[model samples]
Target chain A: MKFRMYLMLPLLLAGLTAQGLEPLSRARLLADRSAVTPGGQETLGLQLVMAPGWHTYADPPGDSGMAPRINFKQPSDLRDASWRFPPPHAFRDAAGVTYGYENVALLLIDARVPPDAPVGGNWTVRADVEWLICRELCRPMFATVELELPVRDREVLFPNWTPLLRRGGWPAARE
Target chain B: MHKAKMWLGIVAVMLLGFGARAEKQAPGFELPDVQGKTYKLADNLGKIVVLEWTNYDCPFVKKFYTAGAMQELQREAVARGVVWLSICSSAPGKQGHFERDEWLRRMQSAKVAVPVLLDPDGKVGRAYGAKTTPHMFVIDAEGRLVYQGGIDDQPSARAQSLEGARNYVREALQALWDGQPVPLAEAKPYGCSVKY
Candidate 1:
């Protein structure tokens, strides 16, 4: 009886561990270019990284249950900054209509800084992103990302993130 | 000169073939209803048919149904001699999965007049590339897909937005009735992800 109990202990523990580490079904934002120009409206490209066999709800979840939302927090000096979302794909469930991206998606946000605002140093833009990821199951996750931009007058300084950011979902430049 | 003429003829034939293939007819499917009687798409040829992917539990679907927007659309569509099919593609264990009796109850409660098609296996859904509840597809009298996408311009889950949004189904049906081409055939759909 003692040996049998010992043998079952490891099996039971393994099951608990597996349940504890249930694969995370959430969206991870990977930004390729974080910097924007003072007088120019540029697109801040982001890639939604979804777990395999899982999908993140698209913006404006139509009739479905989940929607991915983005909240921006920038310094008061930075004005007229807004986020733009790419077109969403539709998914169906028994409950109704929903929108999301399966595998991965490239999202573009148009942001602008005030032309006459304070310049000459680095400015940090932060975003609080919330989204729901679902596969056979569903899970919600929240993440915060900070983007550093060098402020300048009449000049745009865009960061070079082609290698790492491209992997996430950034599209190649069109001719 | 003869060889050039032959090549041109071949090119024209290829172009015509490509055009025909591009306008391929929508695939036919048979799905069960709340009573388990199968509804076949082929049987409904020579008439306009609207296929609505649905999930009863989804808030977005609730927005339209609860607001009576979907029923209103259905009534108008049927008045114009259109057959409306509301399909549910939820898997057995996923949210929105329902038995025949439950679906009937829900549809009755929602005051839905259209036939509700049950696609538990999701085979029909996959065949149509249906990704969301409320995903709307319009088939013309010839049984070709004329439109596919959201039902309207507003993708919000709130019922209030329905009034302001342009309903695509109405527009497509109107265009087809008037013998005019549909101005918009596809639009990005917004809603919760389909639980496939």
Candidate 2:
């Protein structure tokens, strides 16, 4: 039990850091449900955390900033139904104003699952994303995220994101 | 006569190639440094000069200064009889803008010997098309703009990014000083957007 405790301490600390404090940014893909029913829509999201003084560009991140983008990598049958983002704040620069997120931002995507997907089977959805984070200098960050879901009964992780999922449902245009 | 004709054609083609590579006359500017000295670009005519865009708070700039990469390059440039001028184009109330006394103190503390010229209105930065903090430009003795781009190939903000990357600014200056055409005349700069 003592050995197990020692092992779990680092894991707990790491989890906390990943959740709240990261060196630059920490990103993870999440799903609204643990299972996908045939002919149903699935909502996917990226949980992104930014460290102090760092910010990522928003959609339409003005003339000088690069907007963050995500691409589906696996489960070829999945098609993007919609991409959603929260409103971004305008940060004034010397010559122009840029739109971006400060502390954290949730990027959501709604995907349509093929109606013929077999029940009782497990499927993994993979995503690749590119984002620019800047405070003093800028760094381009690429993250590969995956979320596994079952077609039948399984443990659901939706409860954790229920509050956030209830926020704005469509991509924001202004802030 | 045929041999001479071929040589003439070759020279003409070479000149055309040079013309298409974004060369232009360097713009003139008179800006006050932290010490209140006005530096007129025209005053430095007949000597090779390097223009550097800088923001002290920028991580990309730190990647060079913290490692002494920029200082070493500045020393080398001076030794080669080149005048290096560092320009800060951040407008008033922007992230990198600083008051005169504080700016002087910071430069002195960092041991950066070059003049940190203030471009509060961004007129000079716009004239030179400086996009990012640390954008670099090299002007030849004849006042022709010969090179413009990033300091190096790797654009990462981390200090380790310096490890195998080619320093474009250094390479360009060396080539120009050697009286040879710069191998790569222009490369897209990568860093935080200039506050201007």
Candidate 3:
């Protein structure tokens, strides 16, 4: 057990900082369910934890900056229904106003699993994400994140992440 | 005399309103190049002028520079007798704000052939409403501000976007050369906010 725990340490750390550019931001995928049922709706989250003083842009980044882009690459049986981001904070620059998320941003997407998907198998969803994070200067960073869950006959919510998903359902837009 | 004065006042007000609605005349200013040579906008009134808001450190501007896209455009426009002026509006002590020596080095390394005008005070930039590093403006030979916006449609900072991307500045110049109205006179300029 001790040897196994030592071997798993790096893996756990890797999960925590998965696809992160040093001194910028960490990105990882989170699933609301431990297992997904075929023909059921599921929620997936792309979590971004930015370093202090850095931010990623929202859609329509106002006078300048590019918005974050995500390309799904996994789970052929799953189709994205909708994607939403919580309201972002407005950053006023010398030139104009920019809308972005600072510190931490969780982007949620609703996906539907096809009824014909095979049960007892695993479903993995991968996303290729790109963002331009800026403070004084901007850097274009991209990462690939994956989340895997077993395909079960019944829905099985993952306790830890499900509450977060529920509580953070799209907040009111900022005026 | 009273009626004539009243009519003149009404005409003046109408003219002011029309001027406000019409395309603004490009503001005239004199700025020094990296070599300390002065360039006055009024002196170039009879020639087409292109104003390029640039900041080398910004990734969006860097994208065009690294891909040689921006240089090619400048050369093409200059070869066609259009005066191309690269303006840096970054405030002092900010990114892309460089001394004359540094500016010379950067231009040499980047093979920039056009004159780079320094607007460290940002007066010219603000007058032109330049909000982004790569914001572009084209003035016709008659000194009217004809176009102002992004250099192109691809807003990403990635150099790969240069491939097959439509060059708006080129299109505007082509329209003017062909005596046709510019297809896209204005677009949402995208890039890092000007340091000013």
lDDT of 3 by residue, A1-175 (tens): 9999999999988865744325488678887788999887877888877888998888788878888777687764344445577787899888878998887777887887778779998887888777888898777777788888889999898777744543344444222
Error of 3 at A110 (Å): 2.5
Enumerate the candidates' DockQ scores in order: 0.17, 0.15, 0.57
Off by over 4 Å in 2: A1-25, A29-131, A134-175, B1-21
Alpha-carbon interface RMSD for all candidates, in angstroms: 6.1, 4.3, 1.1
lDDT of each: 0.70, 0.77, 0.83
Candidate 1 DockQ vs. native:
0.17
Per-residue lDDT of B1-196 in model 3, one digit per residue for the tens? 9999999999879744531121478888899998999999999988989999999999989999988889999999999999999999999999999998999999999999999999999999888888898999999999888888888888787787788888889999999888888788788788899999
Cα lDDT tens digits for candidate 1, B176-195: 99999988877756554566
TM-score of each prediction: 0.57, 0.60, 0.82
True contacts kept of 3: 0.87
Clash pairs of candidate 2? none
Worst 10 residues of 3 chain A by lDDT: A166-175
CAPRI tier of model 1: incorrect
